[model samples]
Target: MIFLRNILFYPAFYLGSVFFVLASVVSIPIGPAPLRWSVAAWSRFHRTCLRWLLGIKIEVEGQLSREPVFYAVRHESFFEAIDAPAMYDTPVTFAKHELSIIPGWGRAAKAYGMIFVERDQGAKALRKMVSAAREYSQEGRPLVIYPEGTRTPHGEAGKLQAGFAGLYKLIGLPVVPVAVNSGPMYHRFWKRPGTITYRIGETIPPGLPRAEIEARVIAAINALN
Candidate 1:
């Protein structure tokens, strides 16, 4: 039954994605505002599919950050990745460098203000990430980063990436860690049905020692595990 559900979901999700990408492309001449709308709509569409077809639901347990602060989210699966647009109101987000390569979709995502991180580029990439995040911060927008850098298994924790600390220190905003347990439900090839809870952890003030902030973030984002 789960396999059958996944079979149904794959086409629906991809088709919906293609529809939104085309909508974004057509809206290009008008400007990026419409692209943002398209992305939001696509996220809603995904949520609907997750609930109805896959019997999965999302539960965010804490208040979202309304101020211009940085959010450090747990990376357990692609579930939270697509849920970001719905999780917060047009917050600035970061993605892996590779996603920026996909032809049409990548262009639209870039226009949507996603900061693609090149994990291997060292200090150069960190500088670019900080610069882009600062501009968003100046605009009173919340920024989100996956502190773990990559997705780990459901019950395990990963080390906080250097870029997470680098951006937090330079962007000069309080960090709010968000923990989610979605791996057991949605991390595999055939996603299971269950609730994915997003718990907003305590906020850490800016300018703390590197070790302290990193330790706090690691503990907070893995709170669900």
Candidate 2:
């Protein structure tokens, strides 16, 4: 029965995503102000679909940062990337430049302030991230980043990337370390059909040197293990 449910669920989820993409494209040239709230609304709907369609429940512990801050999250499953915008009031992600090459999804990402990074052009990517993060922070939105650069296969804590440290120093904002355990349960191919927990830690206040901040983020997340 679970297998049957999974088979039926994916198609509906795909259709919902298509509908969202079409709706977002039609809404874009109108400008970001009006579209911002709508995007958040749709994201919530999308997260709901994932909850029902995929049977993955999410639990968030601790409080999100009170002020505009940067979130360094552990990436593992597709669930976190898709579900983040819904979890926060306004979220701006730092994603790879390749995501923009994708046809439909890329457009939606652009509308929601997804900052694209060119991995090959490291200096340019850091500069862009700083600028976007400053702008988004001023708007009182949290900038979300996967410091590991890519998803860990099964929620293992991967080596932290230097890009996060660079961004932390550039933006000079508080860092919120989010430890997540998503793979033993909601992994894509071997998904266990259960809950995924996002354990948020207290904001690591700014003013420390970049290395210290990076260590703090890593320590906070590792504490969850």
Candidate 3:
């Protein structure tokens, strides 16, 4: 049944993606803000399709604070990336600059408040992230950053990256530690068929030093695993 579902699922998902690409392009001339919301809605629709296709249900926890709090989340699966847009009404993602290079995906990402960082230019990228995140916060939107910087395979915890502390310092907003566990279901290899949940936690106030903040975020995620 899982094999049959996977086969049926991907094609429908791809077709839906193409439609979203068209809707996004059509909305472009209309204006970016509207386009952004349209794309976000489209993404949510896409994830809903994925859930139905893969038979993967999601259970999200903790309140997504009404304020524009900075969310430091763990990276594990494609599910996480897709889940963010669906979960938040207004989400600004801090993704790698390379993602912006992809053809249709790149354009869609930029449309949605997705900021890219030049991997080679470490310091410059950090500064750019802070600036971009602050700009989003000023605009009254939440920023979603995968503190690990990249996706870690299956159950392994990816090494924590450096920018979260700086971003927290720059934004000066309370940090909401998001611990996601999609392992029992999604994986690069086994790809078990089941639901993947995103368990969001309460906001960790910013009084702690940079090191402590990093440790706290990691600990929060590890605890759930």
Candidate 4:
């Protein structure tokens, strides 16, 4: 049954994504609000597919802040990335610079307020990221970033990427670390039925020393492990 469902889901999900991407292209010129809404609708559609087709459900713990802040999330799978805008209202998410160049989807992501980072570009990239983050903060949008930089396998706790600490300090917003155990269930081609939980940890205020803040974020985001 699971195998059959997975087979059905792959085509439906991809085809639905293409439709959403095309819809985003038409909405892009209208501005960020429309683009963001279209993306959120896509995320919700994905959630529905996960629930009905795969028997996978999402359970979020703790409160999401009303004020704008930074969210450093565990990178377990692509599930969290697509689900983010649905989790937070019009969040400013970070994606690789390469993804931002991917024709139609890339242009829509830019219009929808995603920040692309070129890790190899060093200080210059950090400057651009900070500038964009500040602009989003002013607009009352939370910034979501994957601190580990890439997906890690289940049970593995990877080091936070180099740019995270710098971005945290430079952006100067309160940080919320979110721990998610979505890898074991959602990362595979043939997924299992289970609840994927987002365990939101306490918000760490900005301006602590680098070591202290980094330590706090690392511990918090890995809390479930």
CA-lDDT, candidates in order:
0.88, 0.77, 0.76, 0.90
**Clashing residue pairs found in predicted model 1:** none
Q: Where is model 1 more than 4 Å wrong at Cα?
A: none
As a whole number from 0 to 100, the lDDT of residue 41 in candidate 4 is 91
Question: Which ten residues in a row are the worst by lDDT in model 1?
Answer: 160-169
Residues 6-35, model 3: lDDT tens digits = 777777777888887777777777887777
lDDT of 3: 0.76
TM-score of each: 0.96, 0.91, 0.91, 0.97
lDDT of 3 at 189: 40
Clashing pairs in 3: none
Give the per-residue Cα lDDT of candidate 1 at 216: 91
State the lDDT of candidate 2 residue by residue for 199-220, as single tens digits.
9987888778877877778777
Better of 2 and 3 by lDDT: 2
1 versus 3: better TM-score goes to: 1
lDDT for each residue of candidate 4 in 1-225, tens digit (9 for 90 to 100): 989889888888889999999999999888766777789999999998899988999999999999999999998889989899789988999999899888799988988889998888889989999999999999899999999999988788888887898998899999999999999888988987899999999999998888898888889888777
For all candidates, what are the clash counts? 0, 0, 0, 0
Whole-structure CA lDDT of model 1: 0.88
Residue 91 lDDT (model 3): 87
Evaluated against the true structure, the overall lDDT of model 2 is: 0.77
RMSD of each: 1.1, 1.8, 1.8, 0.9
